[model samples]
Target: MRLNQFISHHSKYSRREADRLIEEGRVNIEKNKADFNTVLEVGQRVFIDGKYLKAQNQDLYTVIVYHKPKGEIVSKKDDRDRRIVYDTLGAKYAHFISVGRLDFASEGLLLLTDSKNVARQLMQSDLEREYILKIKGSVTKEMIEAMEKGLSLQNATLGAHHKSKIKAMDFAPFLKYEVTKEGTNFSRLKVSITEGKNRELRRFFAYFKREVVDLRRVRYGWIELNALPVGKIRFLNKTEYKLLHQFLSKNDKNFYVSKKYI
Candidate 1:
């Protein structure tokens, strides 16, 4: 990994902070001052301020589930000065990396981990995400067709962030969907999809001229929100950890879990 990423993954420093440390000549790799672009190899020894930054025990890591509430950005710091997930997570979890993101207007089960590798794995995996949505207007056949057959839009920015440069997007077929409440003014439905593209659900509904009034994720892979209250966090239970261990073992040949996690 790059020096900045190595520091960020193993220490409390952010990638930007790691770069600053390198610039200040406080970081060294094998007794030589490291640059921002330095890439570390296996068994490399890193020192910061003459103190060794021990390599992580790949078998040991922690994962937490946070019922992220609406109105909070999933970032370390926001230029807009809005509330961020760390504000609620507190300093104790300041270094944890979020697996994926629940947009500012969306809420529900969010995974965070102290291991950057774990976070990257989960985020990039094609795990099913289940959501309950309350949308404007009834579910139409057109929407159902798109959900079932998949969709591709060249101007897929309707429900995306204003600063997003992603104008085109290809959507995979939804895993499943069920309409629980149908009405002209609003409708409620539960849907599952494997991809976690930017504002994907919102963009899909927007294509049908429907607005998602409320969106909440209830499940991701084997993990569920269950009865977790809004804005609270809990460590992954033993069962979840076991499942995670199985998944990691399958995906990464080098990955190992401590017996405690199994």
Candidate 2:
């Protein structure tokens, strides 16, 4: 592995912090000063600031899926005194961090992991997430086509800034969507996307002049919410973990058959 990746995988410092240490001449491999791109072989001794660092602990990792409920925040502490996900999770999971966040009004499948490297890799990977939403009213086929083709929205908050600083952005390349159920005044649909931009789904509906009455992320990557009760937590089975690791590494469409660890 690259030296900086190794450092961040094994230590508290992040990859950027490790690069800074390398630039400052504080990292060494086998008694020689190391560089950011240095390749580290297994069993090679590593030192940081003249102190020996241990090899990466492949087994000391944890990844869990938490069933977040609506009205509960994804953070550990909330100044508004609303319920937080960590408060629902037992003490055993206090050290883990949520992979991504669900806003106060939205909830569903959320991931928690003890490994920062795993979390970071998965976040940057092109893994798919599926959300099931209930909109306040029916959507026309034309709007669906426009959504599939993508839409652009401007940031009005930047109005106070200079025109050059005003931000306009496009959200496109939506993977797939289907209307599952329709009622007189409500509709339900499933939407899938590869990238989890901040409140992207909600914004997508808002652009069409509709409001989401209920939102739940029922699937993330290879995992599903299934029958897990709200506020419950469970570890990813070996198969799920392996698939996630492989997806992050290769971005393959075919599921890897090997049961080996990454």
| Residue lDDT tens for model 2, 1-262 | 8999888777767678889999999999889989867998878888999999886455457788888989898876788798888788867776576788877788899999877756776787677899999997887876688668977778622212132343465677678888999876999999888877667777677666667778899888889999899888888887787777666446533423343544
Which candidate wins on lDDT?
A: 1
Residue 207 Cα positional deviation in candidate 1, in Å, after optimal superposition:
0.7
Best candidate, TM-score-wise? 1
Looking at candidate 2, what is the lDDT of residue 9?
A: 73
Worst 10 residues of 1 by lDDT: 253-262
Tens digit of per-residue lDDT, candidate 1, span 1-262:
8999888778989889999999999999888988977899988999999999987776789999999999999998999999999999999999789998989999999999988879888998999999999999999999999999999999998888899898999999999999999998999999999977899999989989999889999999999999999999999999999999988889888887679866
Q: Provide the lDDT at 102 for model 2.
A: 79
TM-score of each: 0.93, 0.71
Model 2: lDDT of residue 75: 76
- Once fitted onto the true fold, the runs of candidate 2 whose alpha carbons sit more than 4 angstroms away are 1-60, 156-167, 251-262
